[model samples]
Target: MKKYLPLIIAILLLALAYLTGYSKYIGLAWYGKATLIGGAGGIILTLGAYWFDKNRLNITLIALFAITTAVTYYYARIFIDSADFEPTAGFVWYIGYHIGVALFIPTVAYILQKILPQSASIE
Candidate 1:
């Protein structure tokens, strides 16, 4: 229940971004902003979980939530202003984007885990 809130929010955000035709303005700044917001939210949610004695923090999921939120926000902004918005493209775009992220996150995280300081690992 409480443990699932972050994922739920992430999914909802992605759904709105894609379904509402808002991906046209997505860009780096948008990604950065989303990342910061998602990360902060994850931290807060983790704290809540600890206080509530529900599920403990899951670093990988937290990272996925943060990264997905950031990416979704960027996609929304990038496509939001497209004059030729095709309603169908949103679904296709979401599937393709998520597939890419699914493949990319673990690999990138693996590399980062090796290169970055141990403190930086999501765990």
Candidate 2:
């Protein structure tokens, strides 16, 4: 159970991120969109690669970031037109910014996991 906790938390956070995006209440729909598609892509890629490769996690994370950035930009046109919000940057720049943020999750998680001390047992 302890070994799987981090995975479970990551999954839950992904879900929560999507829900928040779908809700569109916090004005961060781009994040929600990115997480939704990226996470789905990640899951699919992870499962598909699991049998052939030992680096499924890394592959999934990379795919998630790439897909999320692409999808978010693809969908952003519709969102921007439908909503009244204005973007400060061009579409390419906006997408790049979001991608940077989206990719931060895995990078930060990796760093934290490496820097933090592990517990001998989880209660």
Candidate 3:
């Protein structure tokens, strides 16, 4: 049960963000702040997952990325005007964004894990 905590927390966060209409605020200040918070949360949760199970880091990160992308896309489609939403271009950008976050958050978390004292445990 403990091993699944990070993924659970991530799913909850994704659900909260989705239900709250978070993506509807894109291009606004609150959306930027939300992105930062979400990014930090992702790093923390991914790090926790990594600590709990070193072997499953990649899968955990991928799952988190997929959740984020799905939620973002879902809300974007509803709120954004179809005239401005190019399916191909938007999807390509979304993929790029996911790749960037999926790679960056874990790398930063790994570095922070190494830098911080071993006594500091996320669990």
Candidate 4:
């Protein structure tokens, strides 16, 4: 269950984003929804990659994630550009940022845990 916590969190985020009407806060119509969905998809894919590779950070996962993200960004341009609200931060940029965090968070957590003096006592 601990290993799958990230996946559970990702699923919950998607639920909250759509089911709770949080997408409306980003923009009107499909723009906000698409961005939130795509971004959540990115997070889910990264965390879910652990099912295939134990190494949360790995070449194959990175490559696959990059390809998927590119495809998502390309297809999302129409709705993103047509957003009713002014897009201050580039839509694709925010999505990529979220994906970037997803890709690296595991390693960061690992490093943080090991860096603490408490790790020595635990080991």
Misplaced by over 4 Å in model 4 are: 27-48, 57-61, 68-123
lDDT (Cα, tens digit) per residue for candidate 3, span 12-72: 5544555676644432123444455555566676767666775456566677668768867
lDDT-best of 2 and 4: 4
Candidate 4 clash pair list: none
Cα lDDT for residue 68, candidate 1: 64
Provide the lowest-lDDT 10-residue window in model 2.
Answer: 114-123
| lDDT of prediction 2 | 0.49
lDDT, each prediction: 0.45, 0.49, 0.53, 0.50
Candidate 3: where are CA atoms >4 Å away?
1-36, 80-103, 107-123
How far does residue 76 in candidate 1 sit from its true spot (Å)? 0.3
Question: Candidate 2 has which clashing residue pairs, if any?
Answer: none
Once model 3 is optimally superposed onto the true structure by TM-score, how far is the C-alpha of residue 82 displaced, in angstroms?
7.8
Q: What's the true lDDT of residue 50 in model 4? A: 61
Candidate 4 structure quality by residue, lDDT tens digits, 56-81: 43554557667757866684765467
Superposition TM-score, candidate 1 onto the true structure: 0.30
Quote model 3's TM-score. 0.38
Would you estimate the TM-scores of all the predictions?
0.30, 0.37, 0.38, 0.39
Q: Which residue pairs show collisions in model 3?
A: none
